[model samples]
Target: MSALLDEIFDVAGSVVLVTGAGSGIGRTIAETLAACGATVIGADRDEDRLGEIKDTQGVEPVHLDVADAGAVDNVVNSIVENHGRLDVVFANAGIARGGGLTTPQGTIDAFDLTAWHELLDVNVHGVVHTVRAAARPMKRQASGSIVVTASTAGLRADPLVSYSYVVAKAGVVNLVRQAALDLARWQVRVNAIAPGPFKTNIGGGGPIDPAVEARWGSTVALGRMGETRELRGLALLLASNASSFMTGCVYPVDGGALLQSLSLDPAE
Candidate 1:
């Protein structure tokens, strides 16, 4: 069992790249991969956030804006050029704007188009750029793993999240499936990780009050919000050889949040 686990989960020496590595789940994933002996290049738009992890043992920080296709391409191409191969790419940069439909801003008729476009640029277009950029080298190598951070909101309606967020995540869910089919011949794998609410800096980076925490927690069968570290295991599983035969699948790392209807705030 030990040998099997080691053989399947071994990620040592792999060249992994994670976007949105400045904070939140991306930061956790990057750090964990680096600790596991993979050479991790963490890219994010925030140089300050990148600086926080620049000196970590195996994490190399790069300033990048995933929304910019050219920028994403440049960084990805540079990595493959320098390393000779790109093993894993995580398209995890995203943003959340506007509250649920309970809020006037979140309702369809009252929705802010400006906010919608802005969120889409990062959440949706960002993933497209990252995946397209990563697909090139992965296809060339004929073996690689691409993981996108989707959300449980993508799979089902959640009145707590913004409309733009839900739409973007759902887009990537299918994007993963389509890309998986397109890249399968080359043996490159594509998949999405649909995470439930975890303590992260997505909407605004800060700690949630107990009351708010409890509200989100109640929706989860686990009766609590998830810690960032909890996602590391699944992130590693999808990135490593342990899931060699898996592709085009959306793995929910939500603490059973999808097991039942979401506990939403009252519609205003």
Candidate 2:
């Protein structure tokens, strides 16, 4: 049984790259893969965060901004050039800069266009850039796995998240399917992880308010937000041979949040 498990979950020696790896789900994914014996490359725009993980064994930290198409291309190319292979990529870098309609700044009538465009640039264009650049070598090798970080907001209307967050994620969800189809011909797999709320730095690094947490918890069937560690198992599965036959699927690791509505009203 142990051997069977190893065969399925083993990712030893594989070269994997994770963007947005400075913190949150991306960091967990990078750390988990490194611990499992894969050569992990963690990329993030924050130099300080990169510095934190640079010394971690099996992890090669790279300073990068995914929104910059040129930088993303260079990073992807450099990886293949230096290592000769990139078996997996987690295009996970993203930002949530705006708020829902409940707040004055988040209201549609007064929506911040600058914030919207900035978020889209990173969340949408960044994913596109990463996937496009990674596909080059993956196609040449005739094998690779690209995992995207989408959100539950993208799957449905939610008043809790910002407009940019929802719009960007929704774009990537379909982009995953489209890319999966195109890459399938080269034996490359593309998939999306549509996560619900987890304890992460996306909302700025700190503990969430008790009241907000309570409200968010109520929307999830599990009655709470997920921890970053809960994502490791699924991420490993998607990254390893266990999911060799899987592609183009958006797996939700949301503690069953997708099953409930994002309504704050008790009457609803």
Candidate 3:
């Protein structure tokens, strides 16, 4: 058993950058990090949301769009230039585009291509650009932790979801491994979070899709969607010295989703 002090996630002297910190799980992560004593700089495309985070939570807010390559670099430069040191970065920005190959008629080519590009632009390239921009300063500082949000679709494609979403999320998983190895020399750690069905705005916000609600009601062992706050402990673990030796690993937070083998592996 570890002592309370030893197990505590320490960030008292560190600064953390959380992209997409305007709402949902991202907002939860930023607020939790701040509550744990880290000076959090929350970045999001929604200036109004950023304002809310600032006014309500007192977190330092910066407007940023991770999908914009230029903004990725500029936001990172400004943060490092201002703070003089960045200790943690959560590349949690993402979007979901849903459509099956069997969509009921109408511009099939446009629909498929747009879905692919939009998901990739926001999911894969978002992480890539964010990592690239943050890495230089983190390397110079000689310490940092990066957490990217992947998905259960990343581990295995779900016919229930669009192909583009799975492909992009899977890319994030591998990107974390590659980045971890690349940054090890600089004392920076890179890892990812593969979240299962959680109550968030990923799949068209509002109430859960009736179909998904019915399925999770039975299909999931937990028997319902997860609350965003449940991820706070894991988020802080990945962002702090508590996980000093962990890297290049895709930590799945699914409620037993990955453990079930549904005759889906490529091998017979």
Give all candidates' CA lDDT scores: 0.91, 0.92, 0.81
Q: Which parts of model 3 are misplaced by more than 4 Å?
A: 1-3, 100-111, 261-268
List model 2 lDDT by residue over 1-268, tens digit each.
Answer: 9999989999998999999999999999999999999999999999988998988888999999999999999999999999999999999999998888666777678889999999999999999999999999999999999999998988998888888888999999999999999999999999999999888888877788888787778888999988999999989998998999999999888889988766635334
- lDDT score, residue 46, model 2? 93
RMSD of 3: 3.9
What lDDT tens digits, residue by residue, belong to model 1 across residues 1-268?
Answer: 9988878899999999999999999999999999999999999998889999988889999999988999999999999988899999999998888878667777778888888999999999999999999999888888999999999999988888888889999999999999999999999999999999888888777778877788788888898988989988889998899889999999998889999786545421
Q: Which stretches of candidate 2 lie over 4 Å from their true place?
A: 264-268
Q: Listing every candidate in turn, what is its Cα RMSD in Å to the true structure after a full C-alpha superposition?
A: 1.5, 1.4, 3.9
Q: What is the Cα-based lDDT of residue 100 in candidate 3?
A: 41
Candidate 3 structure quality by residue, lDDT tens digits, 56-175? 453689988888999989888887788888889999988778664334321245456766788899888989999998898989988899999998879985644567877898889999
Best by lDDT: 2
Quote each prediction's TM-score: 0.97, 0.97, 0.89
Q: Between candidates 1 and 3, name the one with more favorable lDDT.
A: 1
Q: Kindly indicate the candidate among 1 and 3 with the higher TM-score.
A: 1
